[model samples]
Target: MLATCLAQGTSGSPTVRVMSRDTQALLDTGSVVTLLRPVLAGGKAGEPMEVACVHGGTRTYDTCHVVIRTPHGVFTAQAGIVPNLPVPLLIGRDCPIFRPNKVWHVDGYDKLKPFGIAISGCIDGYSRRLMWLSSDSTNNNPAVIARYYLQCVSNCGVVPARLRTDCGTENGDMAAIQCSLREDHTDEFAGPLSHMYGTSTANQRIESWWSIFRKQRTQFWMDLFSDLRDRHYFNGTHEHKCLVWYVLLGIFQKELDEHRELWNNHTIRPVRQSLCPSGKPETMYHLPHRFGGRDCGFQVDPQVLQEFKDLLPPTNSLCGDDNLQYFANLERQSQLAPPINWPAAVDNYLTLKEMAGL
Candidate 1:
């Protein structure tokens, strides 16, 4: 058997040519029950056909059209027709994927306006699905991010094989959770390569999803009610602080929930030169194991979680004047007041009185 390296133009890709078509095939990565082409579709009888195949140049192939035969049922399938030689079935960074509890991306955005709504999000790197999205008075709390991580694993029935974060201090809480998963712990997150620490630019998948929510109503909604350009809304008028606050919070939560639905179902944008069929993240997330994809058997440790909960910062701290709400009485706006520490107020009053000798 002989082979020759076909030289490509400066802008063209190089190619390899074999002396004959009856060469032995080998797949070293894993066992191969059967040698098969990936592009053949089922529901049709197998047939040998010659088709024009163009890559660097046009050629013809006497390839057979047959579906993949797996021990199980036809596991999955995909086919595409391209105008030119299929887009270089290649591109920028390949989409990061791993079975659940294998990989996750963690980041928070603080782009909310004067009201300062902040949120933290986590995405399954493999499935490209949003694992967790949580908003609170603050996004900088390590404990809060950790709680969201715990909640995601608890509800989703999976843990990350690896975790990715933008190196923000708040994400450090994950380290404690990792530490809690000691040598004696189960295999839920036993992998040592648990976190992929990267920058905002490097963590593209989760960051791009943030734009989905931001585009919906980051500045647009806040500007609608708050005196965005005028004096500070917190001090300008009482209405700015209370009137539309709960309304803002209420509506945004609903929008975020709806946005998550739209996002989970949206077609994943293909990476630069990928030829794989675009898919919904939700499908990969929920049905991974059904189609030969692996699943990380992640189980949340209750005692470990309870121990971590004690280390988190208090989430009930009042950060702004507009932290208003409506509970049993939906029209209880009148009862809402900026969190006022009366002790500090009394001390300031007494000091002022002494200074004025009144």
Candidate 2:
């Protein structure tokens, strides 16, 4: 088995390391690596052994842990811990305590106890929900897509004077989004939605979003959710469900629907009273969706993304303290609006929309 690829051996597989006595602390220096016969000899002499084999004109390793048990004591001589099991073996290392074969019942089954049984299911109920929302929804509700998009926005940290979204009906209007310079500073968030790229492009962002989502949240959930199985970083956490609704809303124009709470108490920056009489009217501060660009009212031709290189500065050239701050704030915001009972949230939206008669 070790000679073929069907099983791996510490002798050479990249994933497995074969250690020497110095490394293992189990075997001694100059101690030979060998294999003991699995079956005992007819008399009290016990099993004969030889280290590693060159048989049929081929050098091969063993898959079993065959070792000698002398009257002095039994030691791991060869067949290092099922070598083909892909375990590392340090040569000359002192072998660990050994499990010896005892008297056995004629029936064979009379001895060992049964191993426990286990079960599993789709553990990441939340990630599964997000995947469902992203793949199923046509609205691209900012609420549903909130988790993924906001994470990126938070991660990127550039609160642009303008923002862009694919022309999906979901990002229809950046209802909740708003941006403005810290002061009458040079940068006014300005950028246009990429109307040319369709849902295919949307899916790409979705995939990337899943990658990050899994990285941040899955391991924690797996540690807690299932002892028998593992949870994926993306498909396994409840936060994924909560995050989906937020991303959905952000993608949809529904962001404006939620921003009301943020503005009532959200402090974007310190009031530069010297700059404005009323210490900077809170209403004046706006995000990209609130003003400017093709999504809001400006005429941005769809061709610009192809020539985006000419439109915006390179990342290193453009990034500065503010970009970092913006990213930090975005991450904070994700914490703020983690996923809620989304079905209820949607039902509330429908109820409100019906009341509004639009």
Q: Candidate 1 residues 59-117, lDDT tens each?
A: 32222222322212222212121223222111111212234444577888776634545
Q: RMSD to native for every prediction?
A: 13.3, 26.4
Candidate achieving the largest TM-score: 1
Model 2: per-residue Cα lDDT over 1-358, one tens digit each: 1111111122211121122111111211112232222231122232222232112123433334334443234444334332332223432212222111000000001000111111000000101112111221122333333333333234334322232233444343222332211123332222221111222222222333334334553343333324312323223232333232233333222332333233223333332111111111123222222222111122222333224223332222112345435433554644434325444434433333233232
Q: Name the best candidate (by lDDT).
A: 1
Give per-candidate clash totals: 13, 58
Error of 1 at 114 (Å): 3.7
TM-score of each: 0.56, 0.18
Candidate 2 error regions (>4 Å): 1-140, 143-162, 166-168, 175-209, 219-358
Q: What is the C-alpha lDDT of each candidate?
A: 0.46, 0.26
Q: Which 10 consecutive positions of candidate 2 have the poorest summed lDDT?
A: 103-112
